[model samples]
Target: MWHAVKTLNAHNGYVCALIAKVARYSVSAALRKESVALVYKSHGDPMQVLKLQKLNLPALGDSEVLIKMLAAPINPADINMVQGTYAVLPELPAVGGNEGVGQVLEVGGHVTSFRPGDWVIPRDAGLGTWRKELVLKEHALLRVPSDIPLACAATLSVNPCTAIRMLSDFENLQPGNSVIQNAANSGVGQAVIQIAATKGIKTINVVRNRPNFQTLTEYLQSLGADYVITEESLRKPEMKDIFKNIPHPRLALNCVGGKSATEMLRHLQHGGTMVTYGGMAKQPVTAPVSSLIFKNVKLCGFWMTQWKRDHEHEMGELNEMISSLCSLIRQGKLKAPAYTEVPITDYKTALENAMKPFSSSKQILVM
Candidate 1:
């Protein structure tokens, strides 16, 4: 009886050891598969609504690719989207960013367009770019060259793309032709300057008068702005003096609506075009009656998101634009805007800084 009892105890100990090993393996597997994202359950102030939580990524499908995000920037549009004031809104409990660059970590069996180690950006907006990792359909992302700077790659989609499209689609601007734009220090505005300079199309940039106005002007000039003037200067009688050096602008880009836009209209050459891509002042674009009726100045708007959706069937144009911009960056003719890098763990501070007025440096979230 004593030997039988000892044998029973030994069997029970061995079973317990096996159970313990299996439990350890399960926990290790769970730890190996992890993902976290900055999510908002409801729409309101981003600071209050945005929360970081663990996410359960779906298993890779036959046409999907797994990506690990590298970096994303906080643009005013992102803040507006988070505040529920943007034109397009994602479904509830959505991620906070619309732009970023990521590297392909894995691809499904039938995914032919991308391979592991390739870099990509969302082909369209609202892909929820703030997460550390995600699995997406192969068609939803576009490959970007890995040779460019991470900052440039992360920010390439929206601002630069918008700038190029507006410059190309609106008018047939040629060398020596001038483009006037308000909010000239903006990301898109800076891109417009560099691209226009490359084509020898002059840019007359208008920025708000700041305490460091001269310094800002010099910086913009360094980026290829042909002329940098203050918003107040646009109303002055001497504003016509700018035309003496360069012809009255044939293209006017208005990100600032209302009075600034009206003043910009006064300087456009008869029959010029003004493309409104943003409303930074939260005001309506007002065209002077005379300018529209007599000058025949055209007032129009361009939304990059809508353009992408409309061109969904034709991706070749999008790919060509991205390639051209990347080439310009490689040649040092185009550059990323000034930025401040913040870790994903410290997102609140970055959001706050991004919301501050006159905050010149772009806040980029780095994973």
Candidate 2:
């Protein structure tokens, strides 16, 4: 009887030890699967609505890829979307960012376009980029070269693409031709200036009169702008000689509407095209009937989102453009815009910082 009792006690002790080991293993596995995301249940003030939530990342599906985010830029359209003013809005309880670069951590059995460790960005805007980790279908991501700089990759899809499209699609421009643009200090404007310079085209850049106008002018000039003038100077007589250095602009890019846009139109050569991409002034783009009739200038508008929808651009074309841009970046012919990196945990600080005026640097959320 004593021997039987001793054997039963020993067996019970072994069973308890095994249970504890299983519990510990389960806990460790759960910790490995945890992730964090910036999410909003509704659209309103971004700082007020965004929340950081903890979640367990789901297992990869047959056609899905698990992405670990690297970096995302805070764009004006993102802010507008959060405020419910953008032309397109994501569903409720959505992620915050629209564009970013991510590293693939895993790929599902059926996934083909990507492999583990590949770099990718969302094919289009509004893929919920402001998260530590996410799972997306294989087709939803645009794979970029692994060797490209991460910061350049993070911002590659929007501003640079917009500039390239506007420069190419608007008018038939050749080497030695000239282009003019307002908001030349902006990301797209800067891109246009550098890109045009690379192609042997000239740019007449117009910027607002700021306290540091001289410093800003020098900065844009350093980026290969043929000429940089103040918005107020666009109406002055001195602009003609500036045009004489090149020629009357054949294509004028207008981002700031109202009187500034009209003044830009005044510089347009006969039969020129002025493309309006944004209206920061919240005012209408009013053109004098005389200029439109006498000068034969054409007025047009470009929204990158709409352009994406209408064209249905294939990946090969985008990949080729991105590769060319990447080469330019590598060779120092193109410079990525200055950016301020904010950690994901302090997203509120990032959102607020992005709205500040005269900062001169984009606020990027880094995970």
Q: Which is the leading candidate under TM-score?
A: 1
Best by lDDT: 1
Candidate 1 displacement at residue 360 in angstroms: 1.1
- Put down candidate 2 lDDT per residue, 96-190, tens digits, no spaces: 78788999999989998999999998776666688888777787787887776777888888888889889999898998899999989888888
Summarize candidate 1's per-residue lDDT along 124-161 as a digit string, tens digits: 77777887987778988999999999999999999999
In terms of lDDT, model 1 sits at: 0.84
Evaluated at residue 163, the lDDT of candidate 1 is 95
Each candidate structure's TM-score, on Cα atoms with residue i matched to residue i, is 0.90, 0.88
Measured by TM-score, how close is model 1 to the native structure? 0.90
